[model samples]
Target chain A: MSRVRLSFTPAPVHVRTARLVGVAVARRAGVAEELLDEVRLAIGEACARAVALHRQYGLTELVLVEMSDGPTYTVRVIDRAPIEAGLGLAALPPDELADEALTDEALTVGVGFALLAGFVEDLQVRPVDEGVGTEVRMAWPVGR
Target chain B: MDLSLTTRAIGEHTVLEVGGEVDVYTAPRLRERLVELIDGGARRIIVDLGRVDFLDSTGLGVLVGALKRLRPVNGSFGLICDKEPLLKIFRITALDQVFPIYATLEAAISADSSGSGSGE
Candidate 1:
């Protein structure tokens, strides 16, 4: 297995850079062309969410990305900003998860977990290190 | 990558040609341009995405926001996107139902000008 890690400031400009790096690493891992688009979008959204969270919480730490490549490509975007209260996926009731609740304004305002969930093969969002921040874990098969 | 937008007036319709990547880094610029056009009384707008190399959820959000902004004034917003990668994004998000997407700029402009647009 091959592993790569990248670190970036919580800035909008770095989101694109992180995405490019993820795509490059995925390409080298033999991820197919059609799957590259999904990789690109998923990583971009993950970085964008990280940046927005840092800005919202007035945090000053870097966003870290870890990638592992083998039969499956796995990416973990770690943000040093806590998930906002009541916004955690586990915190919301089942009824609130409906598509009607995701307004354009809401989606634009940093509620992109749904988009990430839709694009990746697997997704896990959880607090990291005694609730200091959030980690977004995403993975997809290499050939898919 | 940076985004470039150029505007042209086609009779009653306004066309905005977009080029380059439209991700989180560049989507804000597109959103601002669309807001400016809407604020300036542009009721019929066509966004040509033929030159756009990439688009993500952030870009889709801006397009949806623009469509919502036009709804209050009975404005129409249409997209010209033929590329499969871009079209696939819309399809994945089910946004193809929200915006009137055409395969070409001429088709979008003609349809909008003829009052047979889908944004209504």
Candidate 2:
């Protein structure tokens, strides 16, 4: 598997920083329009959640990573936060999800992961360092 | 995939018919449409999302921003959310209460309700 990696401290609400870096890295490997935006958004959304968790749960810095597996570009957001970090976003605060109309129970757990699954071609979330940090990985098909 | 946006005028209201997924990538385009309508001097805007296949936070943000933008100018804004999943997401987030929602665009257009504007 061919892969490339980059790391960042995850600045506060700095989506541009993440997208710029991710796209730059992915572009070198031939990522296109809709897929590019998909990756960009999924990366930012996952990282933003990680950032919130770090602030809410206590972590040093967030890590934005990307990998190329020949046919696809996969990005993994690494952060030290509780597993619920992904679950909480299922029912985002009204202010954050101001245009959505879902219920807390309907949201359930792992909803963010579900959204990530739907947006990204392939999605995976697993514990890093035995659950000390979470790694949210998403892959998009980018043919040669 | 390219998103499709259509506009229809009923009485004094303008309904923007949105189709396709409303996620991060498409949200920006929708925001552009909202601004275009406002710039074109269309005050009464009803974002008809009946055809919207998917709605995410990024998409929702554009609407919230639009709501804020329409308010300061004392413009009317409402939404038509027929999809149950979409409705559930909005309800969970309490956004349904924040934005005037109607079963159909005609119902929202009939309300003639204008929101207070303050853009972010």
Per DockQ, the best of the predicted structures is: 1
Candidate 1 backbone collisions, by pair: none
Model 2 C-alpha lDDT per residue in residues A50-114, reported as the tens digit of each score: 66567666566656565666667778777777765544434345454432353322332234444
lDDT of 2 by residue, B4-109 (tens): 8999888778889999766545667888999999889888888888887656566666777777668668777888888776786566446676778789765675
Q: Find the candidate with the highest TM-score and give its number.
A: 1
Clashes of each: 0, 15
Q: Which ranges of candidate 1 are over 4 A from the true structure?
A: A84-105, A109-111, A129-131
Number of the top-ranking candidate, with lDDT as the measure: 1
Residue-level lDDT of model 1, residues B11-65, one tens digit each, is: 8889999999988888889999999999999999999999998887678778878
TM-score of chain B of 2: 0.89
| DockQ per model, Cα | 0.38, 0.14
